[model samples]
Target: MATCLASGLGLRATAWSQTTDGQTQAESAKADPSQAEPSSGDTSSAVKSDTTTVTVTGKKKAPNDRDVYDVSKDLDAKTGTAADALNKIPGVNVDPSGNVTYHGRNVVVYLNGRPSLMLSGDNRGVALKSMPSAYISTIEVISNPGAQQSSGDGAPIININTQRNMPPGMFGSLSARYSSPAGSLETAFLGITKDKLSITLIGSYLNNEMDSRSLSQTSVLDSTDATLQASSSKGEGRSSYRGPFLMANLQYDLGPNDVLAAAFNYNRMPSDSTDISHAVSQAADGAVTNLFDQSGAGRFVTESAGLSGNYTHYGQKPDETLKMDGSLARSASQNDFRSANTYLISTIPGNTGTRIQTHDRRNDKTKANMHAEYNTPIGDDQLTLGAEVDLEDNTINSRVFGPADNDDNLMVNPLLTDDFRSHQVVSAFYATFQREVTPRWTVLLGLRGEVLHLATNDLTYRTKGNINYSRLNPSLFATYVISSQQKVRFNYTHRQQRPEASDLNPHIVYSSDTSVDAGNPGLKPQESDAIEARYEFNGKGLNYGLRGFWRGDSRTITTVSQIIPDPQGLGNIVTQSTRVNWRRRSAYGVSADVSRQISNKLMFSADATLTQSALRNPQISGVRSATSVDGGFSLNYFFKKGDRIFASYKRVGKSYTGQGYTTGSGQANIQYSRKLTDKFDLELMVDDLFRQTRTVTVIDTPLLQTRFVSSRQSPTFMIGLSRHFSRFGPMRAPAN
Candidate 1:
């Protein structure tokens, strides 16, 4: 294999009420909307509402600073998870492993405009894949965030808003879905709105399944371009997960201008997986030097729980508020893996003997966060001040055993065993101001200061280290109106990405028979400067927009591999991979998107981006650049009785890495939904219609060259049934 490395990695203000031309305060707010606000700021134009007071009217509208997608009407919401719905949105990509990216940059996800410990921790992938999407009202994407946002390194932000504002009484939904190859899901939602108290509950049971295969070839070449050793392998794997998830949200109106909210979530997942592989090694003469077959199986269980509370107080003055939030979460996992290697041919002594290996690993993580922000009106402008503290504690224990050199008894392998612990703390403070300089012009300026402390301990190696860093980030956002239908906006910010505890572990971990992965404690954090300009036209039933962006980064982190002598004293050499920091990197891109409502029943939307990225390092001969193109398009048809049909296709572009590059991949999906009755609905969905989702990695180094292709079995067909009921009366569409 290509030695794949694991890098699994705010509200400011409603603007002061203003009137321009013949527009009223409500109309002006609707037209421009407050652009970038802190996550902890509750005075934003799109702040969450209590379930008892929601109202939606007329056609939907989007703010100038961010892109909003309404998924309550999408077919996927009836049967799929939040991850599936996000992958279909233009300019957003979610890989099969549940990692999310925006325009090829890293992303951070929020729930109801606030950070969630479960969504930001290591189990984020699993949680996103399991959480039902039926309750989602809209998703907002912010490409260039403001300093008020506490996102590390200026990462893009995605906020998910659930349905809110009920008329009172009780309302809920129940859904069951089944897919081919033993995959199924059951979900339930309950909401109660009585007087000043609002309660929401969600529960789900999921059984996820997957089947995939991989083919690869690796070679070791000498200075004369002759292959010293080569190996080829083919592997197939199957895995499944069974899980139960539960969540509860409570909101109480302390008074007309004050509110208190608390949320709790818990989930448990038990999984089993198996893999089989066959390999043959050949020398320069093309003679088989060794042959072996390997089979492996694993059983794992993971559990996570979280609790959060928030309090908001609105001042008597308009656009004035104060908010405080606190959250705590814990997650733990236990895994047991066993593998056996049977040799059929050998040229060295004792090579024909069978070898058995066993691995036991446990991981635990705890997170705590606290945030407070105050917003107040300053003359015709708005000012926001905020402070936040975040703490994380992680522990990992691993033990591995293998056959003894002289006997069949298993012996502990110290090189593959470790007990690691890490603690991290972040404290930040920020200030932001928004001004209406002219009738048609508005600007927001902000600055934030942050301090980070990280400490790690390796019990097995008896090694310890401490890292400390501080940064001051600044941001700017400005908007100019050319006409009633056209507007231009600009943004600039500073961003950074700190190395994770796992990335600085400094311990070698086995990836496969011929490869190993390790971390470097000496790695530095990556920092970048980013800027963007966008022009948009909104008129009648058609909307179109164009954007250009550039980012320059220092200390770029990427994976690099090298040929190393086998630590096990095996005759064959192995590939050892680790993360490294490059001197600098730069990327620039342009994007365009258009949407047209052909009729009341038909709509079409499309988006595309062209990006070029370059990297520089003194160790390399010259700077290298790679061009990438990615795009997506979607079509939706609405029928009578709330029936709908949706179709979409998305492609992810190829980009350059430190030592290698990956190929592009795309897939098509279709879904159909019908109203079976006044209170019941039926839906069907098919993913990877063309089965074109596949990727290839090429690693070319002076001494080692490898090519690996991975493809997942596509074509999953799912059917689902859902029922919606309410006692207070039929609710209106979700808020925009």
Candidate 2:
């Protein structure tokens, strides 16, 4: 099924206590020097015996295993969305399509230390692009997740912390942004609290228009290693996204240390795109064979809604808590596509005609989950136990229509029509123990066991299948304090990524007349083992960290493409692609990050990484390895009256697959934010300053080879205005 699974979505309450207290910790350390950790070479902890107190503030916080970056201090929070803000953070990249990565690796996302259906699977990209950054407080990156965290393909985790549910008061904010090339965004939020209850509501709408261009060349080779047929094509397209998003949260204090919470969220987005392409095909003798013109139009709509409830009880002792939560979510999507292809010149008889094709697809999904967790202190150590269960159901209907025999009427193509239904159940149990091995050393050990049951029915094919599997995952975390200002951490984890619903369905779908896609129902899950070590230093006005990571994966899933005959018996060659499990793969990388406050009003930060990745399979070639480098930097200057200027640039490294590789891409952006009044703010920004972002891919195989390049050059000029208000008092100004 199309399950929106968020690892530990409703549990993992301890993450909040450990990661969400940056401001609180800073305040405590400021108020009392004794509350701060003493380090031999640290200047921030310096204090006189009887006289003055010193307070040092930083833009980010690192507590043992994770790094938390304050989002409100950046200008993007005023002019952009959460996706835009994430692109500015070190070691983090949010691509034009809203895919998020850390150090060239996929990352699972969470909201406020808990998993949310909206932030899982395909929905995550849409949410990140549509959600306003004004509602965010901080962004947390967990390099090596502990056993307590949900695992996905052994990738890291990123948590987006939103500002909500404040003390007894009435608070709210409204923001609007307009951009050239036809784009607009609007956000509104309101919160009310009294006595022991708090309620929050957030709403946002985004309408963005963009243009894209792509060029591709494909060649078919003969037994003598000579090209038999070759084709080249160029396509131009325009697309837009328009959507409204709504969310509500409720929290109530049942007693001194008890709380109850409920949350509801709904989102709907409709998108459309149109593209035209011109292609020419040549024979081995370089003779023109066909000149083709193709035009396509597509429309897609997606809607989702979810409801969740939680209960928490805190014990008298610190870090002791019991939590339980459950959630239900439903999502639906519809896709309609139409395409027309005309051949101006052809070698075959009666081939200079126009062909029309249409596709209609609809998918509906429902998911329910229950989770519970308990954390307690044993002497000076900590122990946690948790359990969770999830259930998912999905239904999909797909139909393809092609030109009828000799007539203009359309007929349903049986080979490309299908009805699919799937149901899945997953259960997991985990335990983690933390202990202080010494005054300067700490360790955490964890183990998790999970069981999955899946069943699918293909009514079109009259086939039914059942799959079940179980596995154990383990994780370890250790940290040693090297000095007052420096420390070292080591981590190890095991993770798995299962095949999604689309990957498990055995239906052949046509992307174009010359391209087809399908799935393998017998594919195995991918598994990975990862280890990492990091060294961190917090100096007077400079902070830096270096991390080295190594990972090995088995049963790695990779795409494989081959030349095949056209399914319609049209005497044409087509590309058929599917996913398969590779034998092994390994990757190792080193990354570094540094941040400094150059002056009272100026701040600078930079990061760089070097990676060596390799893939191996027995079916074809030997081990293939690639080395790549990635780097980025940002500069922020704060002016009087809460005005700020921010500039940043980032580049992603190249990536490789079994038969192909994709080149890297880069972009630069600048923004200006000004406090116009006590309650109003203004912002101006420019994105893709140099318009240097593009994707280039090459695939070489024995029978077929292809090269493709895609570029989207939309340099955005945006202006935004926001306002803050509170019924109880004037809202506090944002941090810089």
Candidate 3:
């Protein structure tokens, strides 16, 4: 199609051309079809009735892999830990509590397309918090995972690709940073690559301290709908952490089509600190019901080590492949806690002294996983088959000494002294088919079947529980190209969330002066059915995406709080928080992301998400619904003087959970970098610009309502000097 000439006399005309097909012609005049004939001789003719248009494209269309993004190119991230860098990703959010979510869905984290034993269980956040970002080459957030992924359906997956085939020869980088709230961080990366072998080492040392103050106001109502007690407590404390982390990977090309890789991970937090807090309570009539002053201090020492191996056999066919991965890991932790309270009010019956309690916990965990996948082409369709086996054995020894009871015996709660052991095993098999049914349509179908065996024993309580179950999960994905530059996708999957060992422990621990925390042994696993639809567009230099998702879950586990008589029998009342399963839970949301480069020197990007979540249970609060909105933006500028400035801001809305709710806070970060030399750079960074990222929560329960707030992020300024050495090859330059 072509357009020419304005419908006005003496109108100025400009010429433009776009290629509709591989054809070109210069027509001198319109002729009757019956008399039309080609000129046999002189092709030199300079008369035309209409101007022809043609367009040439310099590059092929971008690939349809919407789930992958280049870490360095997409996010102008400086040298920082993975936790500090993840905030720059689109549609990814990390809350104040170190929980990572993608589009309001729980995200499974992986390493090099496989689950690493180093990141087993609830340690992903810890790994990200300490591991340097330099170890990562790319971060792939799979929004619609297929059957090859052993993870649950509808759940997102984040695969952190390690630095493969390190810059030829020997190269390394060193950086050190100092933060206000968090102490000092020093990290280094060393890589040696020669021929078909590559070995890389990355390590970090961190010594950080966090100080925060929180105020919790609680109201206890009686059966008559009258406030029986009102408790307001304000506490302040500080916790310091010092640790070291090291990870090494070795890769060797066994042959033209096979590769073997081995890696090891180790991290330790051996330093322990002491913290104390005091709380005072009042009555509903504004009287000093309990003037008890309580203080507690705790110490924790934890260490983890793991080793893994992976082998990849790329068959003769480009896309045919077989992969095998295996890993084994062990983590150990020890905790010692003690608290003392002086009753300014009256003490318990037959007692004239304050209360003292001590709790000690020793935990050890061992895990092993083996997985294998085969990828092949079946005619015009692609097929993937995989199997995985996971085994975990955990043991926890706990002992607690409570306050003196009426009989002068302080060890009143027998459940506090228990030895918990848990053994879990899972075997799974999955199959996936991706077929290009037509030129413009693709369909993906996957099915997974798994058998789970779990056993738990409470040696002290003389109780045990066993579970044996099997489940089959099916998923479907459909993608249709609306045009050369636009596409639409739909996906559905089912996922399950089982209770961790800690969630099933029955040990009682006092989290604060007025709060007693415990776990439920009879807790059930949660399962959800999720579906998503996404539309994507690619223009000149801009990318845009919109997605909508909904999930329905049953047996949702959540923290439930209630006012109860002091289990320690020290008078007054206290709040007890425990985990419970909800009858039903559901959430739905829409999200959007945009990336555009306005010019060569400046660029801007933005993302927004909105969600509505609701939960109901007959045993907890009746039913509640929460709606939230989250949005963020960033700006980057590259100056001609070999300098760069990057700034970002994020404002997240409220997040909902069973029995309680929390509101997200605003966060901001900025950085400036100067290129001192081709191999060395100087940079300044700042975090928590607003210094107001706090965890604010509200617990609306049948017997009590409480409001609490705790600081998460603090204003921190840091200066770092980085040096890079590329001996065998030149490296990619930083932003500037």
Candidate 4:
């Protein structure tokens, strides 16, 4: 019987939050004392009488219980970062490798709700532009996640929910920004609460400078005996970046139903780059043969850290949770390649030749996790049980140097170095059950069981040892309440995705077309089978929703393009790379959203999404098919007593980067705010009003096909001012 229900769910997951009337029902549900009506720089407490509102995850009942987009009043009139306030939600998107998509899939970021260490690369855009979105307060977009959360393949999660009381005393904020074509400047500092324990600190300083120029033209066609070739290119570039960040958080409230929390973070990035290039080639009675010239310089660095903990009880009606976490990270990079080549050969002699290359890389990572949850009810139904444990460690080191004068650089190969390591362990058990089969129908069932173990050491190339995997995930949900404001839902899930540790470490990195990117240890592990359906409607001020989804996978991991044989043997020429796999994939989607209030003070909203994807590889032989779309719209207006005005529009289309396609983008934004008294406030913003330029195109399979273009150096006026203070001091001691 599933091993006695997974060994009684790990012996009740460490005694399910050790009770005491479930810590007084989780401190009266975290004292949500019906709050609302404190605007003018809010200070909480107000709501003359009850306005009844509660809809813990949809199904009727919610005439407003806080949150309709409010990131600390748009970070007191915005200034940037946190992906510029998550691009004002409404179908979210953040590409350029900072990856963050919604409506187009892939989204998973959380910070008070857990999971966040700047989600990889470019430090996730320098930790979302150096924090301070007024320390966020709500930004959830779970796009079909249920099964009590935590899975891979299904994507879309984006939690973020910070700022949880600390205002009975001290508060904080300080900001600054400037940009003139990437000659950037940004500053921030924030602090909070001071009695009964609570503290938050944030800091950021940045300097980015840039200049780039380019021009290109190309045409080539060769059919058996038919041939033609023509090409031209010119380029110039300069780059510089300096990033600094610090984050701290602490909380203690051990008394009113125990609580304690701690966190710390740091980031530093240093970068430099310079380049120049010229080229020309022609054939087919156009003569020119070939001519080329180039130059370069580069550098990089990164660091990260995190720690976490949580505990709760609050007696009886389902209330109990416990969690612990830890993390650490490090990075280093370098590249210097000086090049000069001229060829037109009139006799294998003199044409000028020079090349020098040096490359280096280092990385380290560590992680730990623990979990617990409990809520009981059996007869009238309603139950939840959980258990979890996870651990990870990774390391990579690389080095290379070439050029000792021709002969293919004296047959290169010496300095080539490599070292990669990995270790992972995961264990889980879960159960959930809910019922009320009528009274408007409701039913939920969930089950999870997992075990994974992996190990590798001194992996210098292919083949190493140790591996084990196991899984059993299941879920089902249904809900109906066709009146009093409509509602309907259905869901099914089975998800899994494991194989990260640099995709099974086997070291070799450094590419941006200087080729040399490797990793593959006979990779495997990927699973998914998901389904969803939803419909909702709420009146009064109107609100709407519609959703649909389907997913299937059995071994899926993409990014392929190969042509090896250059393990420094030099002569046999061949290089063009990228790898990772366990093919076979499928996807389907639909989405819609609407919100309105055309009267009173005006309001509006909109959202849309569509998707389709397929890939069934045979070592990939062109089985292409894909589609994706995005949308966003917004409007808001309110006059007097605090003021407000806003407008927005966003769109994205043209997908497929697994070697092809990209060219569709749009953006628009406008804002206004006021309140020049009772603690100050003033703001103004205008961005990308109509500026667009984002491109992508790739195809290196069966050899040769490339196109790449990039943009995002944001510029477009902004101004902000803010001030607030209330009973500043005393309240410490809320930790357990």
- lDDT at residue 461 of model 2 (Cα atoms): 85
Better of 3 and 4 by TM-score: 3
lDDT, candidate 4, residue 242?
Answer: 74
TM-score of each: 0.89, 0.89, 0.85, 0.30
Q: Which number leads on lDDT?
A: 2
* Superposition error at 484 for model 4 (Å): 45
lDDT of each prediction vs. the true structure? 0.74, 0.75, 0.67, 0.57
- The parts of candidate 2 lying over 4 Å away from their true place are 1-24, 27-63, 72-79, 347-350, 404-408, 568-572, 727-736
Q: Write the per-residue lDDT of candidate 1 for residues 1-736, one digit (tens) a residue.
A: 0110100001111122222343433333211111111111122123233322312111111234566766664555766788887886778887665678786666899877767656665456667877888767668898887787764645789988766544467888888988876788899989887767778899999887888888888898887668988988889998888889888888777765677888888988888989999888898999997788889899888889989888877665554668898998888989988887777876757666666778888989888999998977677677889999999899988787874433358788888788889999999999988777885677888898989999999898899999999999898988887886678889998867788787888887766667877889998888878899999876656778899999888888878887786654344457888888988889998999877778888888888999998987444589878899988888888898888888888888886776778888887888898988877889898877887778899887667789888987743788889888852343333111
Residue-wise lDDT of candidate 4 within 1-736, one digit each (tens)? 0010001101111111111212321221211111011111101111110122211111211111112344544523334567666777777876433577776666677665556655555567656756656666556666656566666445656776665544444565555655545544354545554444667777777766655555554343343333355455566777777778777777665543345666677777676777777666566577765565656666666666666656554332222233333444343333344443434321223333544445556776666667776755565566778877767677777665553344255332442567778788878778878776776766778888888888887555645657787787888877676764566778787877766666655555645322466656677767878787888665556667788888887777666655454453322122345556646678787888777778767778788888787776554376767888888887777786958777788787676645555666777878777777766566676766776634544453333344445555455656656555432232221111
lDDT of 2 by residue, 1-736 (tens): 1111101112111112111222333332211111122121111211111123322222111235576666655555654688886787787998767778887777888877766668776577678877887667678888888777765456788888776435446888888988879888899878787766678888999888889999989899876679998888899999888999898888776754577888888988899999999988888899888787889899988888899888877665444668899899988889999887787887756565887778888889898889999987687677889999989899988888874333368788888788888998989999988777886788888999989899998888898888899989998988887875678989998988787776777877766767877878898889989899999877656778899999898999888888876674443557888888988999898999888878879888889999999998444567888898888988888899888888899988888887878998888889898989887889998988888779999887766789989998563788899888842232221110
| lDDT of the structure predicted as candidate 1 | 0.74
TM-score for predicted model 3 compared with the true structure: 0.85
RMSD list, candidates in order: 7.4, 6.8, 12.4, 24.1
The C-alpha stretches of model 4 lying farther than 4 A from their native spots are: 1-97, 100-127, 132-144, 147-158, 171-207, 210-227, 230-234, 238-316, 319-698, 701-704, 707-736
Which of the predicted structures, 1 or 4, would earn the higher lDDT when compared with the native?
Answer: 1
Q: Among all windows of ten consecutive residues in candidate 2, which has the lowest summed lDDT?
A: 1-10
Residue 448 lDDT, candidate 1, scale 0-100 = 87
